[model samples]
Target: MEASPSTQSPATKARLRTKTGCSTCRQRRIKCGEEKPACRNCISASRGCVWPGPEELDRRLRKFREQLYPKTTAATKATVIVNNVTPLSPTLLPTDIFSLAELDLIHHWLNVLSDLLVLPNADPACVAGHSFETLRMMTGCSGLKSAILACSASNKSTLSKDPRYQVASLRYYDEAIRYVSDAVADIGHGSKAPSDMLITAMTYLWGPDGELDARKHVAAAITLMKIRYQTAPKQICDSLAASWWYRVVYESVLYQAFFLAIRKPLSPDFDVDPELFQLQGESQHLEPFATVLERQPLILGLPLSLYYLMIAVIKTPQLPEAQRQAQLLELRAELALWETLTDDDKPDADVHSKFQANAVALFVLATSLLLDQMCEQCLLAGSPAELTTTSHTRWQVFAALRLLHRPDVSEMWKRCYLGAWPILVVGYSAHEEEHISSIRSMLRQMVERTGYGEFQRILEELEGLWASKR
Candidate 1:
């Protein structure tokens, strides 16, 4: 063995496993160099080089802190005050302003606000002080914070069944609405406020008085958005702020308003131009809500807005099939856009995914509308067999019915039912048994979840259609 050592070949080296790419790159199925500081691939692509693991970031932060202050005391750490009695001004900004960290803080507060609005037994007063502090820290404009605080306070009191609490809640809602209105007015006067401020204001206004003055507020909000679209920079106008997301929120407000407006008079004073209200391509003359989705594809508001827009249109008599088809095509485009954005391996992938799900739900709604249109056309043309030809018409309708009952489809059902019910009636009358049975099952599920009035109306409509057939 000693003699043969020089002649013996070197032992083969073990194969080394290379580290995989960052999470974002892996998700996108892209190659990554996985370099330090910033990944080479991300830098080359001009994208953010976010690491794969939060643990790595946490470790780095801990190490940095240790290096900065080896003997730092507990008292030196910043403490966020959950409760403070100081009244926030309507137009003041915190000293440390303008950073991603600040934006995250604002988002956190908004989440808390959302939770307070929806969560049963959530204490509004306990949250009020924190809300005020959060508003103060996040917004430079004191008026905006005050309005947010007012809404936060109102959300707390509104949960109570007692008349006193109800009154208090209304008062808070009114105060918040007024402050937000003032802020909006201030923006019109050349104040450099973010467009989101207006959205937040509208949210609070509708949140409280949705059952009262939603239509009027919705109209006002749309007018404001249109004005901004016209005058704001082209970049801002072309961006998400000007797009369907804003319109979607407006549509939601309008839907609530429509429900309330049913009790109000439909005189010349409240009349809007029918053509202008149609959901079609963007135009200056169109209702702001209708154009929002067309302008912004990535915004979650597009689907919601489309859902409500369809509801509004369906309630009206004599909607042209051509127009409906055009709108459905536009919604399909929006869904495609949402898929593209969500599929990107970006930091906001989770949010984009949520938005994609919402878009799918909206697509389901659009399919339902298309189905309704097809059924209506069949009835009008006296071609009963055309309704169940197993072609695009029948399949689309069936697919929509299937999606309507899906767990992920709940958010848009209220709007879906508005469109679906009419189609169901027409289908039942035409003796399309398969479609009728499917729609009936979906409606039954809806009855358990929707309000009493809506459920009763749908049931009555179904019964009346059946009686007419008999």
Candidate 2:
């Protein structure tokens, strides 16, 4: 019962006028006197005279030329043959021809990136090749063509500083930010439940600029965790909710710890004191591993394991000497917990291994930041005895950096040390631009190879630090 294309109503054709008229007169739904160039209506209306109506414009000129010289029979036949070729079908249009499978592949790639952000210890390399493959396929999609153009126009490192690219990048980054914000708003009103993947997506999307708004996302995540924790049956707690709750707690605490480490204050509206502090404390006492051992296979345990460790580092700067000493004792306890998880008897060996690696990297970074802060404290308090401890802390951080062979981690350490180096060296009368230049050159090379754009921001931060010192 499909309608035939040939049976469809024919389009109305516009009629040709023999008279010339003003452009305005032709468009006004009025009749024009059949006159030559510069019609009577145009002259009365004070409009510029225009020649020929839409349909008659070309035909009249052709007729006038035909009067001067007629076309041969062969030329007329060639024109007839040219008009016989039909236009391309709608289904075969450039934009309509993409395979559904290609669209699904692009969706999968986007989801993988989302997975990396929320899940702690996710391997970015797992989707490395897939990203390029998706980009290749996406080139065919006309909808994505505009995105490709925008991405290409704004992708240069140097041009990132230009105002035009800055505006475009902000637009793209804002769209992503708005997406997370909308999800958080949904969870806040209890209108929608928060998923683990959603939390991961928020965390993954957060860049340096995201530090300010992260508390909102973290709060929503915590609310979801509390709801899940309370509503799940006891049997489900052992079988399902435990690992899920742990991830929620871990990521929530990790983001909070990151905020604290960066010296950003928590929002006044966030008042879930117990949930915040509870995750900050040792996970062993907070949640029993024995209860969740069977379900560990289904959860990522690394974020939970590293949460306590990172919190210890975040607490270092604010803690008094006695409190820090006590916390170090607790840190040793948490480190022991980490060691125990790596034991052969652990139920989820793969998760434990990844968690161990991430924990080691975070612990090292936290330790470095702690040592840097401690060094600053000692200098301020004029404590000469603490210098030895400071040196030992630096050595520990250096050794830890060696253990973590990741380029991103290594670059972070380099910047941290670079910030502290001037203080250490200049204090001891060893300041030199050559030394600074050499480090800068090395960092530039690292940035070129890795394409981690945040380091450029770090470099600017370092410049400010050096300027402040001088």
Candidate 3:
């Protein structure tokens, strides 16, 4: 859900040859380059020559808006601000900046990380589109801000191969933990306090450079949420409903499921779809494969459903064998349905839609993994070559990866950000040397393109797995 591309005004579109613009002009992001004390542009513009402070950013943005959108009324501009400026804690990902490297990390978080967190067609209001837009709306919350900084710095270290950045990340992480812990301990009847505590705990998992106990943090948040829901003031509840608090919960659950390889409890009351989609329109350009499992209502409604079901089974290992068997049979039947579904699935025509269709196939494959666990049967699962072309988990993953070769999907394919998880399992099942080589090559490319450390680790694990068998 990256922010819609800003329409570059004709005046601000070009890099005015102001390689030496004054502090004031630079701050305003306007064009100007002249002698100190009073540049001609400044004099003509009737502005001070001194360095404009951060406080003046709003004024400059307004001036630019007036110039560019002259026809827009004040009320219309306010509407724009409301829609565009859902600030998430002053856009601070580093907490505090020191060197240019840290600054670059912040930039990356704003641009790339935000994109990775959301889909291209996601609702901007729901997802943290661009960091600035989110930062604009975020009110003060030190612990949450610190956790975000830690995550950013962690990513920066991974991307830049700079160990020094980890230092700041660790500091911020520790600060967030301390603040959040204290707040939780002293939750003495304040309505907003519990929400703040929960937000801090949820955000900690997203931070970098630590063996964070995510389950503990989540438990704290859950406990606080129960208390807050019952006792919090109406205003606070409304704010939490509209704010990213639910997003925090979603992320925490995802982290627990992904990293721990287990499911957390899903409250019947919890639902995030309304936040994700407002207009219940069709799949847009992605309609060709609309009936595929990826496009299926269930998977689309909750992409994380497979993960949730897996976690539930794992968490409730105490379930009776009869109940377990019944559940497994039900899930397996669901998987079988997806296995035969291919009517509009292959969209080689539109590469963008093809990428999405393949994504759905990946989800179907994920379903297979759980089915194998439940039925204790291979059920179309085997070595890469042995896999059924249309259905098997290994085959689907291979097929999905193959789609990346298309020029349209190649650019995104190179970015291992989205498909890492599926690849990990796909690589694990690669028995043949050629299949193993292909998976390895794909992961290496993903690592090179995204600087996502996990891709490299997955590649190494797969290599080790293959080696051990040999």
Best by TM-score: 3
Give me candidate 1's TM-score against the actual structure.
0.41
**Cα TM-score of candidate 3:** 0.59
Model 3: lDDT of residue 35: 39
lDDT of model number 1: 0.43
Residue by residue across 15-53, what tens digits does model 3's lDDT show? 323224456777777776543335677888898865333
lDDT of 1 by residue, 1-470 (tens): 23355654465222322324565576677777655445788878888765544233333334554675587433222111121112221112222452322232243234333332321122333234334443543356544554444444333232222244345446656666676677667776885643655654664465444445656766665556555545563544354343433333334444433434322211112333344344556644444434444433322233444444444433333346466546545544644544343223334444334434444453444434444554464447533223333333444444455544445434445323243333443343334666667666656544433221344455566667656655
lDDT of 2 by residue, 1-470 (tens): 63366664444233333343345566775776623334678778887755433244335334543664365345324322322222111111122343332222233223322232232333433333333333444454332322322332233222223344445444545554565566567777785555444443443333323446545655655555555454553543453443443333344344443333333211122333354336345533335332342233222333443543544444454557767656656665555555443223334456435444544444434444444454465447644222222323244343333433344344333322122222222222212454445445545543443223444544555566456546
Clashes per candidate, residues 3 or more apart or on different chains = 15, 1, 12
lDDT of each: 0.43, 0.40, 0.50
Best first by lDDT, ranked:
3, 1, 2
